[model samples]
Target: MTIGKTPPRGETIYWVNGKHPWVSISDMVEYGTILTTKEKVSVNAEKLFGDITPTGTLLMSFKLTVGRTAILSIEAYHNEAIISIYPFIDNEYSARNYLFYILPIIANLGDSKDAIKGKTLNSKSLYNLLTPLPPLKEQKRIVAKIEELFDKLK
Candidate 1:
């Protein structure tokens, strides 16, 4: 329920998944963020979606089909449909996967009105939701389990 204080374009703004053709809007658009292979000091907006953010931010879909969450694993900018979260500043640090898991719960808890017809969860409605925060250690454990299960699938 708190409005985040965002720095200007270059001050504290770091985009992850900096590669185009990576960050997409569902299955239609493509390459929303940017791509950088920098080992450190890099964030990626694409992988952030269903992925993680290191020294990063969270991106929530804002347009069309909204409320989808993303994490900044690398530094990059995101589309307007996404609301970025800087856990470092907010003191809300948790594993990116943990955010992905809990965001769905928040979205379901929030109000749902079909403003754009089928798109009931637009950016405005989705971003205003709140969820509980688990300790970083617990989050890490959860993320590890998530990765372990996902790795089994591959």
Candidate 2:
């Protein structure tokens, strides 16, 4: 969907209260990597806004659980309010590894406590989050180094 041409908020198909996965903001946690699923599973495409390919779309709890980002280690459906950011990487490119490295950066940024109901993260404020970008090559190197060190620590 083009930014300027995107449908108005009222016209867009958004996830409502009932359709969302009701998890506590504190329960939502971030991990360096998610365990891979052995069996293949089909998921609803509507839960995700953009591409649904595993490792392609990065899922983050953008609401009250801000900074809890996770890469789709396996092809699974996400709930509404989950901040799904998928870089338009073709089948040849994977952003999952990079997302793992960047998750820390996002988590450290802090979450907004002033929610509409004092229980959820304000989506409007979530969008204004500042994400630092590094060169592609540098990102790759950072991912590799982090992976190596984490492996040793584990």
Candidate 3:
């Protein structure tokens, strides 16, 4: 949603109190997994915020904390501090798992800028962020390898 069109806090009546996962930067962790969320909104709030971002959408924190990333296991809504990135349609190379792994690196590029309040990667900066685009097969292989390595670490 646009900055000018942000829903006011007084609209909490639309919040269903745990019906829809509402994510914030505070919910992000370094492990790249969004296991749970403390906030939720009602269906009305979901409609107001466009739509619930689908499960598996990659969420990245760009404001204060800068490079935290996570994959949404449940469909959810997120505040402005988090940007929900959906895989590109018709692009075989657009793997959500692969993007989850690489987005933190892409987010780090925006960390060079300084904001008066805190480090911020504005919408324009986020829109302009570049990412690697390996072939679909290669992306799947990379994701598998990463998972295997992570399992080994566990």
Candidate 4:
């Protein structure tokens, strides 16, 4: 996915104070869920950013904070710090819940470079990060088991 260009500061107020939720890296959580966000974008901003990320799209932050992941429960737009993953084919084999659980583990395997600023995972490195996928039934079972355990913990 291509990163959206940042709107100039002066124009941001108008472009972001509208109906669409605008997500930044700050909106992501290690727990693999995003409940809400503080920023929003106008339709024009959405146009500039390309398509709205659909509900249940998995989001991962690869820069700065590095390993944060989340699943959007609502339609939203996100900044460059995050990349949205949409499962277009074989939905049964690619469950969003399962991916959410797996992304943080993948992030740890990413190639990290220590620059003058901070640790970052370049797009190429991120693309090359390996992920394990089980059979569709197993994936669903894992997700269900995770939920069950979490519910117990709660």
Q: TM-score each candidate.
A: 0.52, 0.56, 0.79, 0.83
> Candidate 3, residues 5-82: lDDT per residue as tens digits?
224567776664648778888877774677688777776775578767777677877777886778778877888778
On the 0 to 100 scale, the lDDT of residue 64 in model 1 is: 49
Worst 10-residue lDDT window for candidate 2 reads 1-10
Model 4 vs. true fold: TM: 0.83
Per-residue lDDT tens digits for candidate 1, residues 23-104, read: 3344222212224433221343333333333335555554445456655455443333445555542334555557765664
Give me candidate 1's TM-score against the actual structure: 0.52
Which model scores highest in lDDT?
A: 4
What global local distance difference test value does model 1 have? 0.48
Considering TM-score, which of the candidate structures 2 and 3 is the better prediction for this target? Answer: 3
Please list the C-alpha lDDT of all candidates, in the order they appear: 0.48, 0.48, 0.72, 0.75
Q: What TM-score, to 2 decimals, does candidate 2 have?
A: 0.56
**Count of backbone collisions in candidate 1:** 26
| Model 1 error, position 71 (Å) | 3.1
Tell me the tens digit of each residue's lDDT in model 4 across 71-117: 78888888877887765554653566787778777887789877666
